[model samples]
Target: MTARTAALAIAMAAALATVAGCGRKAPLDTPYQAAVDARKEAERNKEPLPPEPEKPVADKRFILDGLID
Candidate 1:
């Protein structure tokens, strides 16, 4: 089609994609939950449970402490 029509279609598609990603209350925890479920299954089967993943530390300085000195 014409250049103007093509540009308008691209702009609308971009806007639709941007809006579609909004409104999530929190990120998915599927990986962590899967790990927990695996551990439970292992326990039921009398096998060793894998170690739980560490929760993220919220402190900004936790990362900077090593580099600061």
Candidate 2:
């Protein structure tokens, strides 16, 4: 093969190798990702998600009483 043809073939091979190396598993394969997907599936099935504790709200009456007393 000519030098130019050999060089072109090498370049094409290198490009193919680079592309072949880029195959990756989907994020859903990970535990955290699986949990996220499961949560989404539960929501789609209308299952209630676990509730978070409510944050405390500032009571103006308590604050005012504290200030007065």
Candidate 3:
């Protein structure tokens, strides 16, 4: 193929890749939910329960922090 045709092919491939990557992403389940699911699955299989997931700590920023910007 001509150099111009090869360059066009590469450009089209890159554009297609960019468009594919822009598709909507799936939402992830929270850690607590994941732990619950694991517990349920273990119960169904008569296996030992897995360790609980740790709770997320809340940020302790000062009240005035929210006033900026």
For each predicted model, how many residue pairs clash, with residues at least 3 apart or on different chains? 0, 0, 0
Per TM-score, what order, best first? 3, 2, 1
Better of 1 and 3 by TM-score: 3
Query: Candidate 2: deviation at residue 35, Å?
Result: 10
Residue-wise C-alpha lDDT for candidate 1, range 1-69, written one tens digit per residue: 999999999999999999998886885767767788888899999998899866555556576689876
Mark the regions of model 2 whose C-alpha exceeds 4 Å error after superposition: 25-69
Residue-wise C-alpha lDDT for candidate 2, range 1-69, written one tens digit per residue: 999999999999999999988976654375555566667787899997644334456556665687767
> For residues 1-69, what per-residue lDDT tens digits would candidate 3 score against the true structure?
999999999999999999989955887878788898998999899999898777778867997997983
lDDT of 2 at 4: 100
Name the runs in model 3 displaced over 4 angstroms: 1-26, 53-69
Which lDDT values do the candidates have, in the order given?
0.83, 0.73, 0.87
Q: TM-scores of the models, in the given order? A: 0.36, 0.39, 0.41
Q: In terms of TM-score, how similar is model 2 to the real structure?
A: 0.39
Using lDDT, give the best candidate's number.
Answer: 3
In candidate 2 the C-alpha lDDT for residue 36 amounts to 68
